[model samples]
Target: MTYAEILSHIYALGRFGIKPGLERISRLMAALGDPQKNLPAVHVVGTNGKGSTASFLSSILTTAGYRTGLFTSPHLISFTERIRIDGREISEDSVVHLAQRVMAAAPPDTTFFEMITALAVLYFAEEGVDIAVFEAGMGGSRDATNILDGLLTVITPVALDHVEYLGADVPEIAAEKASICKPGTPLVSARQVSSAGEAIAAKAAGIGATLYRCGSDFDACWKAGKLEYRGVGVTLHEVVPGLHGRYQSCNAATALAAAEVLSGIGFPLERAALVGGVENASWPGRMEMFDGEPRILLDGAHNPAGAEALADALAEIPRGKLVMVIGVMADKDREPLLSALLPLADLVVTVSPALERALPAAELAESCRRQGAAVEIGGSVAGGVERARELAGADGLVVICGSLFTVGEARGHLLSRPFEAFRG
Candidate 1:
């Protein structure tokens, strides 16, 4: 099959509507000869910060002279962004080739993500990568990517998300993520709810895995505009992660901790490499700022925790006024998300992302209205961002957020012109 044909075939699997299980993935991978087992990997799972942590880890591993393969989900800009090697996206040619091979090997029925995961494993194996960093698409346990036995598993902060599939509470959700840990593998995690932490620890013990908790075994602190991380008798100070938001300090430290664990197992990453990687790593659609006089900030703050971080980041920018353009998926916690952002905005423009799951613009505006914010409905993401820019005037700032879908749309619109052109 041709590349277009391959993509069409893969996209057809979306009809299955996100099956959360390993049977299909396992069967599919087995048909593909279980390529995932041949590649050394670091699996990252969390409600938030998984992408950032995976990107940081990939950068550091690459800097340390390793051919690193990174597989992440829910791409902000392009589908190609989901797979990469050494910071470059998978070429169209490679995608087509892998898709064709996997399609031929896949079971008669397979989910889109499962097929994609299989393709990533195959590509990583073919490229002879020293390590691969895989981000869990949802909760860890039954996530298709969990089929692999990774060298290390990193869990970032777990929160109430995907409640329909994972659970309705934090502990239940944490249990699902903890399911990714394999026997004897090194597992690392950030600070979590006490009950959730206990659950994860119990699971680690049950599997005979070495569990490293952040606050207890390793820690990080921010001082003087720099992040300091201490773990395993090594300390890194004044480290600035390329990704913005104070929350990123925790994610960066988590990635560093995982690196230390890998090194302990003889992976051996240079200290300078770690520092440089953190300084240079970048994850788009998370507080990404476009160059302009009235700077436009874009973030994918779809949930309450993410919204809180976006609010904190907005507080640091010195703008005369803040105009927020937002869109969100229909299933997110809209009330809390609006509560986190509306209080930080001078004006709110609500819009619907170009996705079947997007919440209606009218409904979003009503939520902002209930929060007592001056709101307008913009129908679509482009319209919302444009309206926000107009409302911001010459010296004010325009912030676009709520979902990666919204940020991706805004990015495509903004990239059409030179960055200076967006300036007020």
Candidate 2:
């Protein structure tokens, strides 16, 4: 099969529509010879920071002379972005070959995410990767990727997310993520609510997994123009992560803890590799800035927690007035997301992203209005970004956020140089 044919076949799997259980993926992987079991893995799961943490860990392992495979979800630009080896995205040939193999193994009905997860494992194993970092696509336990055994399990900050699937309360959500822990696999986690932390600790103990809790077993501090990370047999100073947002310090810390645990398991990562990875790793569509006057900031703040982080980041910039161009998925917690962002905006330009699941521009405008922000509707993401730039004048800030799809659209606009060039 050709690359285009592979994509078409995988896209056709979307007809199954997001099966939230591991039975189908487990069966599919078994038929494919359980490729996931042949490779060592670091499983990263949480409501937020999983992608950044996974990227950091993968980069560190690669710098330490290990062949690393990184798997993430909800690609910003292309499907290939979901899988990578040593920072290079999966090639067309690799995608085609793997898709053909997986299609042969899968049942007549399979979800898109399941096929992709199986492909990632097969590709990583075939490439002989020394270590693979897998990010959970959604709630753990039932998540397709959780079917694999992990040498080190890292959980970033957990919050209220995926209420429809995971549960409305923090403890219920924490329990779902904790299901990824396996016996003899050391579990590392950030400090969470007391109830949530207890639930995770109990799960780890039940499975004979040593629990390494942040703030107790490991910690990170951001101060004096540096990020200080300290954990068992690991210490770093003045570390600067490539990603923005103060919350990244915690993500870096979680990665460090995972690295330390992996070292104990004989992976043996050097401190230099750890430092280099934190400083050099990059993940797009999270507080990504473009080069131009009336600077454009693109963030994928699709959930309430993410929106709050975006709001915090915006507070640090000294703009005359902030003009925001926003779009969001229809199924998201739109009210909470808009409430978090609208307070920081001087004016809001709502637009529809180029995705079938996008909330309509008029609906987004209504949400903004309800949040007490001056709002207008744009026909498309590009139009919204242009309008935001025009309203921000020469020295103001124009932020485009609310969804990864929105950020992707903004990136396409920026790359095409659709806006008028500015002279400083």
Candidate 3:
């Protein structure tokens, strides 16, 4: 199969929708000769910060001379962006080959995510990666990625997103994420709320998995113009992340702790590699900056907690009048996100991603009106960014955020080459 044909077939599998169970993936992996079982794995699961945390660990391992495979979701520019080894994206030819093989071998009922997860593991094994890190698509217990018995499990702070499938609150959601804690494995986590922490602790203890909490066992904080990470029996000072956002300090700390666990298990990670990796890690579409007269910032702050974090990060930056270009998914909790972001904006341009799940631009405009934030309804992603840039002028700042789908589209427009999603 050619790249286009492969991608078209994979996108068509989206119609099967999100089947939130591991049975199909487990079977699919077995059919692919159980590639996941042949490799060492690290699992990172959370409602937020999963990508950043995984990116950090991947960088650290890659810098330490290990053949590290990083698999993430919701690519910013391309489907090929989701799989990388030693920071190099999976080749288009490889994607075509893998997709064709999976298509031929997998069940017809396999969902998009399940097929992709199996493909990632198969590719990682074929590429002979020393280790791999997987970010779950949803709740860990049933998510396709959970089929791997990862040596180290990192859970970033659990929050209330994906409420319908993961449950309606933080604690319930944490329970589903905590299910990734295999017996006797080390589970490292960010400092979560009381309820979330309690659930994770209980699950870890019940299964005899050692639980390492950020605030309690290890910590990372951005303070006084520097990032300070103290974890894994080492302290990093004056660390600078390649990614933008003050919230990244916590993610860096989580990665450091996870790397330390891997080192403890006989994977040698040098102190110098740890320092350099944390400072050099980059994840796109999370506070990504594009330089110009009117600066562009793209962030996928799709949930209320993420929006609040984005707001705090924005407050810390020195920029002129903030103009926002926004779009959101229909099932998201919109009120809190609008409350968190709109007030920080001088002008808001509302748009919709080219996805069936996206909320209408006019509807989002009404929500912004309720929040007392001035907004313009831009029915197209490219049109919305243009309008926001016009509103921002030359000296003002334009922030594009809300959904990953929205950021992906806006990024394509600004960069002059969009990622081909299912719609494209």
TM-score of 3: 0.95
TM-score (all chains, Cα) for each model? 0.94, 0.93, 0.95
Model 2, stretches more than 4 Å misplaced?
Answer: 163-168, 416-424
lDDT of 1 by residue, 301-372 (tens): 988888899888777778878999988889777898898989988899999977778899999888889889
lDDT of 3 by residue, 321-389 (tens): 789999998987889888999989999999998878899999999999988998889898899998888
**Cα misplacement distance, residue 190 of candidate 3 (Å):** 0.8
What's the CA error at residue 262 for candidate 2, in Å? 0.9
Tens digits of lDDT, candidate 2, 390-411: 9988888999988888887788
RMSD of candidate 2 to the truth, in angstroms, is 4.2
For every candidate structure, what is the RMSD over all alpha carbons to the true structure, in angstroms?
3.8, 4.2, 1.9
Residue 341 displacement (Å), model 1: 0.6
Task: For model 2, name the residue pairs that clash.
Answer: none
Best by lDDT: 3
Could you give me the TM-score of model 2 versus the true structure?
A: 0.93
Report the alpha-carbon TM-score of model 1 versus the true structure. 0.94
Off by over 4 Å in 1: 417-424
